[model samples]
Target: MEEIFDDPTNEHRKQELGGKDPSPPELLKKIEQLKVELVQKEEKLLEIDLLYEHVSRLTDKIRTAAESGRHNTLLLAKRTNELQKKIKDRTQKMMALTAELSMRQALAIKLQQEMRDKEHFLMVVSSRMDQGLPLPQETESEWLKILRNEKIRSEAAEARARHAAEEAAATAAGGVCSAAQRRPAVYIPDSDYSLPLPRPYGALAPFKPPEPSSHMRHYRKPIIKPTEI
Candidate 1:
């Protein structure tokens, strides 16, 4: 076991391979070589430190740029969301305004139609008055008062005409009726009707048939022809 542990070279040769008891010249040469290696190691350590410092500065710059990019992206996303919300609000407002405009337009059309109908009614009333037709039944209104006045004027004119006709008849039959104490009877002739008399002023306007809608036009009552018995 001792032999297995021991070196194969002699003590003198071992001294040249850095043994504890080395020769003076050998020791001096080894020391010089070690000193050279130490100097080289120091130079390598300085180069490594400089490389590490450069790498650290580059890493710091990259980290700062990444953080700035992240902040910018977050800001951009927030602005995009705000713009979307504003657009949504504007779209809703536009829709509401459009609906309101449509409703107002419909109301205006209805009001115009009512006004036209009222104007037409007034025209009919005036035409009826010009034609000596009785006015329609209505509440106590300005048109009703005008119609009453017209009726009174017409009755008064008819009364005057009757009185004139009676006077003419009496003058013609005066001699014949001289023996009779009673007044002479007068007769007036009319082609289409009896003598003109003051009729009661209780008549209404002439009836006007209503225009039928498309749906009701097809269901009208048919006229029956007269048949011989």
Candidate 2:
């Protein structure tokens, strides 16, 4: 059993091939080789430590960059939201202004039609009077209503002209007017239109009132004469 367990090559070499223990030179060579391997292991350990430190520095830089990115991202999101809110508000204001403009245009068209019809009616009445025909009775209520409408329109036009002039003066002076201006509201007799006045919107110019027609030149006097009597 001992023979089986023992190394066969070493003993057989000593007996048959006359092999001996390694020489001093061979032993020294092996020791030197082992020392070289030890130095290589030390250098490899030092390199690993340097690489570890470098990796730690890189990780720290990446972490700082990531934190800065997060802060910047939050700031950007907040600014973007504020800008969007402003845009939404402006959009709503623009839509409201557009609706107001359409309403004003419709009102103007209706007023123009009424003016044309009144002009035609006045022409007929004037012709009848010129021919010495029987005149219709003057309507006090109707005349009062017409005067009220004309006064309102005139006031509104004046207001708009003043506003434009003030704006222009303010511009030339590089400042704005702080004066609170009042707008004229249409007061229809027994109607619910008394508050919402027309704003000074349109070109940067004074509002010019329509020119008085020749037929309308003698209209107010006849109506007033009848009312006084």
Candidate 3:
């Protein structure tokens, strides 16, 4: 590098006397100039190192936040599935109720159809890609809201189904209609409930370190200065 920084053309027969050595004073002056340049280069390198360290810290924080959000989403997905299963169990019980044949033959056909539809809901609402992709907080919040609405709805639906089941039990026993006035509300599947998707296990993927850049090939961690000359 020092040779390259030297004069290119001959000013005082330097080209013809190329084999001759420089004077002692000239050599010292050249060494001083190189020292100055080295100091400037080192200062620039220091600035770059500080920048890389700052960038690395920020990147790590961002990834940690993303992982946390994804974990929360997985928990939400699990809770929602539990609620769905609860509702499905209640639906099955309601469908199994033995109503009076004369009054419920047509209703039996409808319940059977709904039961088949309920069978299709054995899975969950979350997509499997959640294994690799980070879930947004806003999306998690929306899911929470959906679950709250479903919770309220399931309570109402459960009450209706339980009442119907009791009525059928009474009819099976040949008991006269007890009045809370003899009609029981039927459970209808809510269209707002998303169709079931294949459920995926929520597990963190194994971490693989990123490849180092040309300048960073020597270091493994967040930062390490290059070897000095």
lDDT of each: 0.81, 0.83, 0.75
Question: Each prediction's TM-score against the native?
Answer: 0.36, 0.46, 0.31
Q: 1-229 in candidate 2: lDDT tens per residue?
A: 5664485764543435676899999999999999999999999999999999999999999999999999999999999999999999999999999999999999999999999998987887898889998555564567788999999999999999998998899989997667655434333234486545545444443545666888887666644444564
Q: Of 1 and 3, which scores higher on lDDT? A: 1
lDDT of 3 by residue, 1-229 (tens): 4565475763543425347788999999999999999999999999999999999999999999999999999999999999999999988877667444535888878899988865643222233244555455665788899999999999999998998998899899997657644232332334567544433333533344566669876766767679999
Best by TM-score: 2
Instruction: State the lDDT of candidate 1 residue by residue for 1-229, as single tens digits.
Output: 4664485754543334554787999999999999999999999999999999999999999999999999999999999999999999999999999999999999999999999998998899889989998887672376779999999999999998986777778788873323334522433344476657534333443345566778976796889999999
Clashes of each: 0, 0, 0
Error of 3 at 59 (Å): 3.2
Candidate 2 clash pair list? none
Please give the range of 10 consecutive residues that has the lowest summed lDDT in model 2.
182-191
